[model samples]
Target: MISSAPVIILHGGAGYWEGKNLDSVNSALREASRRGFEEFRRGSSIEAVVEAISFMEDSGVFDAGKGSVKNSEGEVEMDAGIMDGKTLSAGSVVLVRTGSPIRKALEVMKKGKHVIIAERKGNSNTTFNSGKGGDTVGAVALDLEGRIVAGTSTGGISGKEPGRIGDSPIPGAGFYATERVGVSSTGIGEVILRVLPAKEVDTLVSMGILLDDALNSVVNKVSRMFGKGNIGMIGVSKYGDVSAHFNTKGMPRCYQNKEKIQCLVFDGDFS
Candidate 1:
């Protein structure tokens, strides 16, 4: 039995933000969810996903579009991705500076032949040597029209090497959606890229696996496969089943549906 209204889920990031209070992070997640649900009620899954991510990006509390962390050279190199389930269309942008990367991802999905832009030459040599700032923000929403959309934005890791590209702007790596499911992810860009955890979750769910079972099983497998690196994700099925899992200290997250609005900093399984 599904609720009458739509459902939206958001994640501030997957790793720890040193010295920051959970209350403040929880507030940002709550505000983001509330704002995004407004758009969902207006019947636009696309707008809902963007609006939700925009709130977190503007909050400056998360490492996303505006307040993103700087690279080893102290420059901001951002990545973002978005996917619309109904149309099976997606977009992404990398090494971007200015405005919302999520918005640019949408434009890319609509206009470009390529899935991603500006191919970086090599992987960040410091992927495993990161110190703070691995946060990425994202949202998944199932709109009133039964459309599911997913989007993610990130500033990359703090002190990362310049030209270091992560999973955030990769379609299946950081975000994915289909008529049945939508997924968004955060954590160590290197591991997430290797695992493509978001797309894996959607793939499992499409195989008729239960949403929670699919997410938990895949996340655990990814953690085992990677051996090291934080990872967290949020997913929503078209029927409004929602779940989130993080293999880290905490993941600032929030969820809103017809029944309630809940926000929390998860240090445990919050599915």
Candidate 2:
């Protein structure tokens, strides 16, 4: 039988977070990790990821769900994705106006017909931040059954055009899961979509690389391809090992298990 020990990792996003805002981001990351682990203890990896993401969304501490940034037209259009490691089943939604974009993604997974749903038309405009915004939220967990699962949610880039989709709603780009590993990513949606960061890490793990090493390798690749401070990722291997990596100046993140929880505002290697 698998051990009761559970592992969970979560990220608020990657960007220029500092000072007082860093404190709020840290608090939210810690709470999210704690909540996810709680659900993991209940033996549901899926629920753990969902609950953790929902908490972050509701916290209004990150650019997702309730506090999602407005688009060019001053409207909030969110994207989210969820994946199950055991079955490789996945679901995603884009341009959602609901308060729970992550919940909608979960529903898509449960429904199991389509892998994605996207809004059809363009709306109005606003000037949030455009290309410089680094905003996405995600979680990965390993449950007692040894299954790994991952979920990601985002408000899309600041000032993004209405109906524009980002990596958050793309499986293998923002999130990926398999019997071997699970991954979730945050950063520039365009860069992430180009590299499919999550799946790249899993591919390395499948080739016998350690979870941390795989993550580091992917971070290095992104740094070379898109420059530093461009992407961040969190993951869990089926063996309950957890990994988090980013090329950004800061990424609010946390990892937890029965033994203890570790939360940090920036990756040590990045400093």
Candidate 3:
């Protein structure tokens, strides 16, 4: 019997983290993992993933939602995506200006009619920031029922062209999930978009690849193609295994299992 014990993993982003104040980043991941696991314990992976990401979106610690960077025109725009492994159902939103881009993504998923939606912006009375510190935020979860779900939310790179959408809202590019596994990606959206790291991991895992090896292979493949510092991923398998890999100097991340939760930043830097 598949143990009802749930597992979850998440990432802030892939970027130079050799030196930078990350107290807030670490705290956010820890809190997210704790809250996400609680939701997973009683609900579905979908709920847990959403609840976790929604917190980060409003945390003002990452390049999403409140912490979204401005475009060349100086306005906050964001993108988000969520996927259900059991039904292969997914939803995404792009170029939106709101305090809860993750919720908008969830709304699109529940809508069923459209898998993706775009917006010029929203009139949410929310404050914006320079988007200092983080890059993107994402999560992958395996529920007690063995179902998996993955989701990603991002504000894109700073000073990007207006209406420019990255991999965050694109299935297979930023996130993918199957009954067997779930994957979420962060870092250089353009580079990530080129290789579809999330889907690649799913394909490799389905083909008998170990979750850890598949995650590493994706990073190696991306590193070879685009060089290092361009990719990071988190994965959760139906059997409750989890993995995190990235080529950048740092990818703030954490994972929770039956044992415990560990949050990390620079290599060897554990909190």
Candidate 4:
């Protein structure tokens, strides 16, 4: 059965190896999910998404914010996005040099005048002490009032071209939300851009496809075209159906679908 209460899910990235001493990774994921859900109780879905992504960006354990990987020019560029399911409104920033990319994304969303913005200058921040492997951070949540939201943050693919932007800042590509569902994706930005996985999942779910089936089909489709180790996604429905699926070896997450990195929120169970 679908849940009507507040709920949230998050991901650190789509790659990992077994027995890699993921203590830091697991701790950060748990903290983000727990804190994000608390934000939901106090505010709404969008707030929860923002709070969680922000934390991950700062945690330095992933490829976003403080720990964002360096591009080919040995520069750090970042991307972030947010979407409101209740209104289909969005905001995003690309090639940002600031560490607070999530806040910038929120600013764009709040302006309601533009869907995307770009940046090329302004470099501030050093890598976090624990920041390491994970390449992106994403979240999806359903609030107590039925609002669903999705958001993502990334430091861009390591060794990418200096000014290149990925799916992270593209509305339907990296993140998407509608009245029925909210989605956030992490993977090879270029491939994700072509498939627009987030939007695709929203379309399928709206067409009466069950959540699991919809996610499964998308993963299968991506696998057929791009092979594995390319994508990971997390989502929440208005009625509180939560899911995480990835085509990569694994993604740091809080749900068990064959394998999961962590499960700290909602009592480690999904309704």
How far residue 144's Cα lies from its native spot in candidate 4, in Å, is 1.0
Q: Could you tell me the TM-score of candidate 4?
A: 0.91
Instruction: Extract clashing residue pairs from model 4.
Output: 60-131, 63-134
Estimated TM-score for each candidate: 0.89, 0.91, 0.95, 0.91
> How many steric overlaps are in each model, in order?
0, 7, 0, 2
Q: Which candidate ranks first by TM-score, i.e. highest? A: 3
TM-score of candidate 1 versus the correct structure, residues matched by position: 0.89
lDDT by residue (tens digit), candidate 4, 1-271: 2444577788888765456557888888888877787785579888888988898888888899987888787778889999998988899998888668988999999999999999858765555433355778999888778898889999988788888989988988899999988888988988999999999998999999877677778988999999988888888776677787787766777632112224632112343
Query: lDDT of each prediction vs. the true structure?
Result: 0.81, 0.82, 0.86, 0.80
Residues 116-231 of candidate 1 have per-residue lDDT tens digits of 87634343332221223337999999977889999999988888888899988887888999998899988888888888888888889888997778878877997788753478
lDDT of 3 by residue, 138-213 (tens): 9998877878999999999989998999999999999999987899999888898889989999999999988888
lDDT score for residue 93 of model 2: 89
Better of 1 and 3 by lDDT: 3
| Global Cα RMSD, each model | 4.7, 4.0, 2.3, 3.8
Highest lDDT scorer:
3
Candidate 4 Cα misplacement greater than 4 A, ranges: 1-4, 125-131, 255-271
Candidate scoring better on TM-score of 2 and 3 = 3
* Per-residue lDDT value at 110 in model 4: 94
